[model samples]
Target: MSQTPIRRLAAREPEFLSTLDALLAFEAEADGRIDAAVTEILQAVRTTGDAAVVEYTRRFDGLDVQSMVALELPRSELLLALDSLRPEQREALTIAADRVRVYHERQKGESWEFTEADGTRLGQKVTPLDRVGLYVPGGRASYPSSVLMNAIPAKVAGVGELIMVVPTPRGEKNPLVLAAAAITGVDRVFTIGGAQAVAALAYGTQTIPQVDKIVGPGNAYVAEAKRRVFGTVGIDMVAGPSEVLIISDGSGHADWVAMDLFAQAEHDELAQSILLCTDAGFIDAVHDAIDRLLPTMPRRDTIARSLANRGALIHVDSLEQACALANRIAPEHLELALEDAEDWIAHIRHAGAIFVGHWAVEALGDYCAGPNHVLPTMRSARFSSPLGTYDFQKRTSIVHISQAGAQHLGKVASILAHGEGLQAHARSAEMRLKV
Candidate 1:
């Protein structure tokens, strides 16, 4: 087996910041080929609608279905998939779905307003989207957890329609994914994927209803399609590769930490798994543990490539320095595997999600930890956020002014509009004002 050598860094080194910056940078923009292909697909769907969708499905997924109705999976089919799952599989899906649903239910926003003394009311009205589309990766990347994370939130947010699109490459489907959709109340499921699915959702077709927003993860083509169709429809985000940054105090077992790193690396060859610690001796111990354990993993080749390329083991002067570096990276998943993990929680200014304590493995959060695992990646945590019920809902500002309130407010508007040199705007406000 090939050995995975983790890059070593020291906070005291003169070029530490420059090296760290290079490692943290991840290019998120799609290439021209993907962008052009996505553009063509979007235009095709926009022009031809259902015919373009069918042709794309046939071309990409190797499915020769003639009509869109043949591509859709009925609600009964979703239920049947749920029932067909093994006992353990069904149990796990049920538990995960329930937890995700419960967690998002608390995120539901309400319409709120406050009345003022001048008979004016000011507030924000929160409303669920009319329809949302979920893009689940099919084939080798089938993820039942994604179905739960994306659909359950939309349902909890009171979205009227939850449409799902998963490609059945060569007419193959994963029953667990369908079961998850059934458990989470997905209103519709289509056996379609890639850029065409995104285009269909954004532009709508003769059969597939146009959605207000499109959420969930997909491949490069699907991501590019989302990027192109964003203005026409809302998208969750253009997610990048998986990542995990672990800060250990050397209080826990090295094997546990090694496994956590492996778990992150196994996602793909580009996935990052970095470890930061104050103790040099503990870093060596964890290195040995990784060497001893790498051969045992089924995805060792991928993990090895990931660690060799993107992974690192940093020696910080103190835990304080580790926290500072962590904030700079703004990783997607930050695991503080220390005895006093909660003590330094407030110090972390940016991270998509924090897994505190030795036992709080990032893998647990990926599945049934109750928090949505769909998070900002590629340092996007600096400004973005995790997927939640709020992503499926939108807010509108509400203002109701009485005659007395308008009399005073109109004066302010009139002055501002006239100063900006707009006669129509100034007159509109002046009409509401009385002497």
Candidate 2:
């Protein structure tokens, strides 16, 4: 395929601005399908249970799933297979898992109670959920990193039980995924995936038990299924397509920035890869590198569509303008390719994960990096935090009012309740005052 010529223009070029708007519009339109699909998957999972899950797996995965019982993997075999992994691979996984565990252990919270002015004890109790279900996507691509990312945090949070569901095509499990699960100390493994796996997790089958929260990454259908099953069981977040925004001032090597963009774009056609640069020369150079490298990649078609549609070389007037644009997009991954990145970090108000400096690539954060790769995607960075130990745990506010404390608080409560015209609430407080 002939490489598309790299377009070079001034920072304020009208052509680049129009192209940016067109790409943004396309991404906005793509979200429509996600909403509709999630609704269908959720309703199906809610009412049909195992039957719907089985049928959907067969339809979507092209696997003739006879029963949900096949979802369970024998614990012994999983461990044995893990023990057989190449020593180097096992060592790397161990190292990564340890780093992840250490970082998350620091994020763990403690329960504390304190006596208030009126001798009323007020506190917060931190406790892990009884059970959590993790969904691992399987097909041609299996992410052992994802297994480590999701399972280790839950384990560190002190969750009692950790069950995982990975959709293996035709019930054939990947040893690496199993090894990661085994090494991470996952309680159980289920060979199921797609919307069906999510359904099984949200509403338990005869074999798969329901869980308190479902966490991990998956395809569009899986994301939608999570959105639907939300109220039935907690979900980490409704993730969108992968994205990365790099702010470079032409100081970094063009090849590095190009590869970083490709890493995210290779995820899917909907993935967004953007470069915000003040230097027109750097923009052209990076574009040149991308064109030259594109054909060599295995997922060239996916990368091409992603870049042509959703990705762009955004020419910002200055670094400040680039940072402002980034805050608006709230990209899943933000790469600061500038000379002095730390100086700009304080100005960055939104981003799921930030990779500062040329040496720190997004790929590092995806694998061996201790930070969780399961991040808030699209615009969710504006509010939600990256998946952490807290996602697997819940907090309960504790309040204990003594007789004297109640008497003091009751008068204020009654007054407020009466102002709101809630007579029962007012009387309830009045009754407490009388006692």
Q: Please give each candidate's TM-score.
A: 0.97, 0.91
lDDT per residue, candidate 2, 1-435, as tens digits? 326533333447657556555554433345777777667766786687877777777876677668877557888978887888999988888888888888889899889999988789999999999999999988778999999999999999999999998887865677889999998999998777877788778888777789999999987777777877889999988777888989999999998998888998899878888889998788878888898888899998888888776777877899998998889878889999989999999989999999999999999888888999989877788998889998888999998998899898899999999999999998998898857
Q: Which stretches in model 2 have alpha-carbon errors above 4 Å? A: 5-22, 25-69
Clash pairs, model 2 backbone: 167-192
Residue range 1-435, candidate 1, lDDT tens digits: 324588988889999999999988778665889888888898999999999999999998999789999999999999999999999999988888888888888988999999999999999999999999999999888999999999998999899999999999998899999999999999999999999999999989999999999999998998888888899999999888899999988898999989999998999989999999998888888888999999999999999999988999999989999999999999999999999999999999899999999989999899998999999998889999999999988999999998899899889999999899998998998898875
- What lDDT is reached at residue 230 by model 1? 90
User: In model 1, what are the clashing residue pairs, if there are any?
Assistant: none
lDDT of the candidates, in the order given? 0.92, 0.84
lDDT of 2 at 316: 82
Best by TM-score: 1
**lDDT top scorer:** 1
Worst lDDT window (10 residues) for model 1? 1-10
